[model samples]
Target: MTYKAVFFDIDGTLVNEEKEIPQDTIEAIAQLKESGIDVFIATGRAPYYFQHYAKPLGIDSFVSFNGSYVVYKGKVVHEHPIPEKTLELLESTALANNHPIVMQGAEAGYANYPTTRSIRSLPNRSMICVLRCPATEAATGRRRRCTKRCCIAKLTRNRCTRRPKLRSVT
Candidate 1:
């Protein structure tokens, strides 16, 4: 059996702790493309976070935001944004538990509450910029297409702060 396409994640799987692709991996990707296999990026990161890696890695198709958005050859083929009602539920849940969350739209993103050290340290370690916006801004904003909801679970004030844990509403 043969596969027609291959997908790669951006963070640890594709880039190292230094956030740089290894030379061997780059060569492998080149070989895969040269052999007629279609390569694509599948990442939970917002597209802009990994924008610089695209052309250098020779990838045009992507399934970003944990499959909420999909693009092929620079054209968006699919988009499944979370609804506003769900965002409300998530926001309330995170607030009650004192957990922080970062909601990301196609063009912009921000933290729902005041950030902790861990949250603030994330962007510096990588390219994921956590924009500082007013909390009144909706997670599923009507003005922008919301594609990613990243729940950040951390220990706050010696208590384990859980986040907006997802549950299937069957």
Candidate 2:
């Protein structure tokens, strides 16, 4: 297929379970840029999370917060915020379940509570915030992963390069 632009998913497709982006992948992106192809990352992560990332890859644009937000050349091209009514409903649901709720928007990621209660109660249990589950499990009847680690490993393996770049220093 002939294409003028290429889009990549970030979490599993680019960065692995350890959240490491591969040097080869970065080099590959650089090469693509050198060839005059447009490269972009599509992710559930907020645009700010990509601040330290996109520059090195020569990414021309981004679709963040699961496409609810878009950025080009450090400027917002589009933004879709969750309505307050929806937020209220979700919060109420979560409160009933004694669980935590997280909201991921174009600008940032936020949790109702940063503690483990919120972390443990999430159905899909993604690090990135996306309103995919009901506030309470009873309300949604969602089936969560029986095993988190193995599932995470499988998920990361499927999305990222086998050998990704690793750095020790923060």
Name the TM-score of candidate 1: 0.58
Candidate 2 C-alpha lDDT tens digits along 1-170 = 66677788877676777777888888888877778777888877665566556766767598876777777766778877665455556655775696766555433334534556654544334343222322223344784421211211112322311111111100
Per-model tally of clashing residue pairs: 0, 2
| Model 1 stretches with alpha carbons more than 4 Å out | 88-101, 112-170
How does each model score on TM-score? 0.58, 0.55
Q: Pick the candidate with the highest lDDT.
A: 1
Task: Report residue 161 deviation for candidate 2 (angstroms).
Answer: 40
What is the C-alpha local distance difference test score of each model? 0.61, 0.54
Error of 2 at 75 (Å): 2.2
lDDT of 1 at 75: 89
